[model samples]
Target: MPIDHFHKFLTSAQQEEITLEAAHARLTHFAGRPWLFFPEFSAYVTSFVNAMRNPVAVAPVDASLPLSQYFIKSSHNTYLTGNQFSSKSSIDAYILPLLAGCRSVEIDVLDYKNEPYVYHGYTFTSRIPFKLVLQVIRKYAFVTSDFPLTLSLETHCKAPQQIKMAQYMRDVLGELLVTESLDAEVMDLPSPEQLSRRILIKNKAAAAHDPNSTRPLPDAERHHSAQSSSDGTNSSMPEAKGGPSSSILSKKVKFVSDLAQLNVYHQGSRLPKLPRSSDSPDLGPFQPHFDQIFSLPENKLASYQNDFDRLVRITSTNIIRTFPKYTRVFSGNYNPLSFWAVGSQMVALNYQSFDFHTQMNQALFHPGNRAGYLLKPD
Candidate 1:
């Protein structure tokens, strides 16, 4: 019961979880139920903590399947460290997640000072210089693990800035950026092993119509092809996007044209229905404002159980990303295990907060050497 020993134990706990062997040895003097006096420094590390540290068993992960075959860790508004709006955007948004082994990170790229910046659009969110953010990413892209990083950018920049976005990425990322998979003709996603240490960009492709075509492609036609979860490769570069909405579409066209020439791998776009289980490149679902519509996991399980089954089916095969509900104004996070139970891969968590969901996420990826990607159960 010495104060000095307690202080040392606390200090060590801050750096890493204490091992049970260390705890048992330290509390060897205690006759019985050592945890009663020192609950925090229990003689035994709980089974939960042990399981978190080592998740896999005799069944090793199958790495031969395509990249889309597993659950991909993702982030939604990765730049903002605060709420839906009026929050300060910082490089930490990207840092914390990448450090926690999150594979997919989002960037809200906008036009500012004749250069590109990142922030949530239509909100009072503060902007951070796009170059600086990318610089931070380049520096820490592989700090936690040596796996590929997915940049899920939401571009609101003009054509010039869009081109700059591409150029900056090419310069900053260098060979770490992946433009194509080894076998592009297969149409299915490549294995994570195949895309190790690469960076994947997910942004809506530029629409081809002049924004006033008499017979523009319909909503169905725009997304006719099932875009790969890892997304469309040159798989013959199918025509892209939805019916005309605004002049912005045309501007996007100008930029996507530039990207197409560059041979970008994953073209982000609006997907129609949930993709069925497959090895082919199919569009994955990302349902933003999920909690508002369905509330928490319990409510959804009670009211929309059938839909939950559908989710399990979809996620069992493809990676689906469900973001925090807009109602969580204080940057709160949900228990990601519920979604994981249904097989959703990238349950984009609010890593800024250490909520239960974030803890589960950290634990789930904690096993397997923190490589950031985990295979969904068969």
Candidate 2:
């Protein structure tokens, strides 16, 4: 038989095995026979031997679905069952229902300096270290067999504390740690440098009002530098225009400009660490005293003053429209019980929260929909 036909027959045969010894005898017997003209059966036999010696393991990627549906809100107490490190059974009992619906879990971690613990406040009564909780989770939590379930870790430690304890656990167990909490009003990512610059600008503006800080410029009055054009609008808003001498009064105007920029934010940023008094009316717009800064051409001064006035008006309008959302969430005047009750009902209904979790999940799994969320400055 041709080698091709014989190979095909071997493949088609069911439960038929030719031992190595028997196969070698058959090959030897066939060798040098006139009917078999094959010269390189050795290579074929070697290929077969290698194929039989080593086989690869194949796993299907499509066998599983993502566990994104499972999530935990950090405000309330929630726990996972049968976590490798968590040994608690009762906490897992409370967490079982949430686990069935979701693949990830969350818990709040407050710092306990020397030990792996969880707590809040200055009192010992509030302490609940993570070490104790994980011990129970590992004991009773039923982790998904195929997919690694994530523990959504949240830290409530103060900003200055650089304790590496939690980071250590996150590294070893490969869980997600959410260090920053989203505020009622969304703000840009915290950058210490940006914060410092803003503080410096505010300080400089305050210092300009001090006689001892810097001498008043010698020439506060000067001829109008900005000439009125056919349109009659001062073009100096974006650049230096006819005001007091650009050299002398420019520094003072710039200082005021920096102060105005720093104070441009809504109540929260502008205020000196206090809630707005209920009786006080909103300041309508920024009012920079142009008369102090410049003696401009009549038409040009009006135009420049109007530009400054309009910018403040627009900014305040934006704040008035958007600042309420944050006030509701952050004002602490909210009744916690009422908020909790509503949230509980929504969770019972499996209603998705339109904010953080939804956005975060979308960002992680559905990258295409990621975008920004902004609210007026608080």
In angstroms, give how far residue 291 of model 1 lies from its true place: 27
lDDT of 1 at 184: 42
**Candidates' C-alpha lDDT:** 0.57, 0.27
lDDT of 2 by residue, 77-125 (tens): 2432222122232343323322222223444344466554443122222
Off by over 4 Å in 1: 1-61, 208-254, 260-265, 273-318
Residue 169's lDDT within candidate 2 is 43
> After superposition, which runs of candidate 2 have C-alpha atoms over 4 Å from their true positions?
1-76, 79-101, 119-126, 138-145, 158-162, 167-378
Instruction: Please give the range of 10 consecutive residues that has the lowest summed lDDT in model 2.
Output: 196-205
TM-score of 2: 0.24
> How do the residues 246-319 of candidate 1 rate in per-residue lDDT, one tens digit apiece?
23322333344444333344543332345454453343544311110111222333343445656565444344
